[model samples]
Target: MLARGQNVPTIEQAADFVERRRPEVATLLISRSVLLGSADNFLKSFPGGTLYAVKANPHPEVLACLGASEIAGFDVASIEEAESVRTVCSSKPLHYSHPVKATASIRDAYKIGIRHYVVDSEVELDKILACVSRPLSIAVRLKTPEKSGTYDFNTKFGLHPAESVPLIKRIIDAKVEWGLTFHVGSQCKHPKAFSAAIHVCHSVIENLGKMPGYLNVGGGFPVAYGQERSDLTAYFVEIKAACSRMPRVPLLCEPGRALVAESGTLVVQVIGRADDRVFLSDGVFGSFGEVNYSKIQMTPYHLTRASAVPSLAESEFRVFGPTCDSFDELDQRLLLPATIKEGDWLIFPMMGAYSNALASRFNGFRLPSVELID
Candidate 1:
């Protein structure tokens, strides 16, 4: 049987919950202990202050959990996100990390006591300058090499390191505290990717002839998904070794997926099956946005039959969402037991990061309700 109010319920308990409740709609089970464990991993792995990227999983419970952890603050893209974080934990520092911003957002963020902002161009810097007269802590994002991440963040936002020299100088001249920052990209599996970006920042600092207030490596810290377990220690070791040559300065990181991805699970029921195609209660439009839109690999999943019987036989099957659109099918096929049928449950792990945060109510399918199992 499932144990409610427990901090670390076993997988058997979760399977039992799915078999007993038989929820018609999808269910999201969250574990506070797992969230804390991820937070602790991040706090111990990085050699600098950490900021949770609010865009990854901005659930109120997630925000509150990290707010209470050793995390320094949050990295928000819009004023709404800043306001949301403020509501949960008012005192945590907020950084406007998005490169482009509306003048109104800048003004509202400033009003809400957000002093840190990221800019990649003079136009954005001008916008920030026009919005506030007070000294601001600014991070100039440098366009660096895209070494090895699932998503490339360099194309849309960052300035060439050479071009950032003048911008940083201008920020310093504006009597604002300045810093250098870059994103290695999302799900960065390579440890040297960070070292490479830091090298570029080092060059930029060298050109400036003086160290800035801080060097934010930005968030690309990876977490294990599917069959691979990433070594967080390797990434940390590489970053520490690379930064050894740089001038002594404060360091910061904005970890979104790594801090919250392992804390949640998505439970969906098999609604229908045709030949080798199986339809689920939730799809790309709902909790599987990353799988379709971002092309991120599916999280690890297991099966739980409603009858509580186990199957050892296995076969490959195509998965689809309940949406009317034919494109709702998952990009990759899943291997499941040949006995898998309608009413059986599919429990996906490591879904705490971007699953529900990006869900949409398409086809009149509501987002999954979150249940704290721990």
Candidate 2:
């Protein structure tokens, strides 16, 4: 709603724009200050080189903002993300961080000037070797504890310390720069989880008898969501202490959610309501895709009434998305004013990470429009 090239100075102005326009489509308000501040804080707090994980939120504006920040570079999971980043900041460094990459993607990333690649197994390394020859740095993915974070990634990627020694040796045998990397998992709660993964990396380094060029503590930085919150400083302190024992090498990190989750606020309107179920303009198929899991809760919404109405007590409501599928409902219940009805707007904050990035254009529904705010 504000005219093109015009930006709202605050969330209140953004809400006012929504109220005036009353657009039925969901609108995402991105705070430029929050985005830049998050990047600045992470860069200052993190021990070494920082690479924004492009997979978290690759919105053009998001990429543009981080590209302008002090971030050292970006870690892209696929050729598409690499291309997207290149389009924004052609000179910024790019790391092909995904453990498993398609043959063509490896070739494409190499062509895109990406020299660093991560692998969990020798086969993936071979794939990279077959695609690109020299002037490369390979990071072996070390498997960390599965229960360390809300979402476990050990089952999908990463190699055990015992299994990683030989693989790292092969990376060294190739005469290319070798390093160790591990993900504690996404939305990691326990700061010690990072320390545990670092310990595993140190063990692998000792077993190989070779100092890695760098130690990549892949992103799992937590953010406050619902009642789940942890001090970001605690994570940094734990990581710095653990790395103190390891061989001195450049430290690297790929932070996704921790860098961008708090910069976004999603405003959706109520379309329909039943006894206790309320349908929203957007749902799991849209920006709320992550809400299908009970663990992911977007609560404490600010209601913007379409018309003046008396306030009412809050009550739990089953939230549903604007999709034909029966499974397009959120597993978590939201507490809204009992007088909540159709045409009311519910604004949910801290949604800048995977919301629109994970949305699908199912049933001809478009993704939420993005509005940048200062």
Candidate 3:
């Protein structure tokens, strides 16, 4: 029988066990512990509202959990994502939150009953008006200044606050349904960034002299990659403070990585060991670059038998993937238990979010199969 308790085997032991049992599991475990924890945190922190960003990880299981929790909605970029959410959850509101606008995509999203969307410019507003025939609600993405040490969303989308207020005015003037939304960017470590943006939202609302409909704070919740993460409560406090000033407008948050990143793990077997490095069966092109792009750190563990305790002492080792490209290096200097050896298994945590959604099968690498664990 498989290990049935909470005390599971280390990566090295798991690899040895798999060698005897299910050798085909190239990437085996994606634990629910991290996922549930992250999702629960988001729900608890943002009592105002929460919308799981579908771009993070579109796994049906993840979506099911959010739906069960009565999450506000989904932040989707494409019609396929909209359909995925529809398949998993009942008729919940869907936000076509991608800042950019394509006519065909707009038509499809409108067809699928996506009333909420993000518009940063008048041109996108025009495209949406042309494509969407029915009375639809929209969100104007406000381009706020990027705080220090965070990814900037202003470059791609969102209008200047001054311009946004007028744009909201124009939408109202045109008798079009619309709301106000702002994204501070992704992997935001600063809680004040949201507070600052919320203050801006207040100004915009006051300037518009109407509540509009919804005030989307946009998703920038950070996940613990390598370093210690900030408290979600602090960020929520800022949001609450801002929202309290304008209580009538509904609040929405689009959290992608924080919802599913920690919930999943990537398990790979060591296929080759030579020199000071060990090459795994999976590569960065396979399912690890999501965190890498954000420069997030990862923890690797060795799994083995119950009696065979993998040494906890750490040593520097270059862990590479099966890809031939030089950039395929997963970790330049990963410190793992000294007992890690050939044919061992390595497990990476906080991989449930962006990895699978953004993974590319480059160099003919096969995507890892996902296994959900309770």
Judging by lDDT against the true structure, name the best candidate: 1
Q: Which is better, 2 or 3, measured by TM-score?
A: 2
Per-residue lDDT over 1-374 for candidate 3, one digit per residue giving the tens place of the 0 to 100 score = 11221123333334444555543335635555556666776787685678889988887877877777757778898889989988989667888988786889998888788888788888888898778865778788887766533678777777778888777887887677778888888888788888788778788877777877778888888765644543578788877876777647777888887777656667777777776787888767777675456776666656553323457676888878788988888545787766666666666655677777767787877788876655
Query: Candidate 2 — number of clashing residue pairs?
Result: 0
Q: Which stretches of candidate 3 lie over 4 Å from their true place?
A: 1-25, 32-34, 226-230, 245-248, 304-308
Q: Which residue runs does candidate 1 get wrong by more than 4 Å?
A: 1-10, 293-305
Ranking by lDDT: 1, 2, 3
How do the candidates rank by TM-score, highest first?
1, 2, 3
Best by TM-score: 1
1 or 3, greater by lDDT: 1
Better of 1 and 3 by TM-score: 1
lDDT of 1 by residue, 1-374 (tens): 12222222435556767867878788878788888987897798789999999999988888898899999999999888888898889878999999999999889989999999999999999999999867689999987687578788887899888899999999988899999999998888789999999999999988889789999999988776664544589889998999998888889999999888778778898999999999999998888888765565554345555455556777788999999998888998887777778888877777788888889999899788888776
Clashes of each: 0, 0, 13
Cα lDDT of model 3 overall? 0.73
Question: How many steric clashes does model 3 contain?
Answer: 13
Clashing pairs in 2: none
Q: Which residue pairs of candidate 1 clash?
A: none
For model 2, the run of ten residues with the poorest summed lDDT: 1-10
- Per residue, candidate 2 scores C-alpha lDDT tens digits across 1-374 of 12221222444655775667786999888888988988998899999999999888998899999999999999998888988888889988999888998898888888879999999988998898889979999999988955778788998998889998888888888899998898998888899999988998888878878899999998989887654433499999999999998778899999998888878878898999999999999999988877666276566454556542324687888989998999898888888788888888877767888898988899998889887866
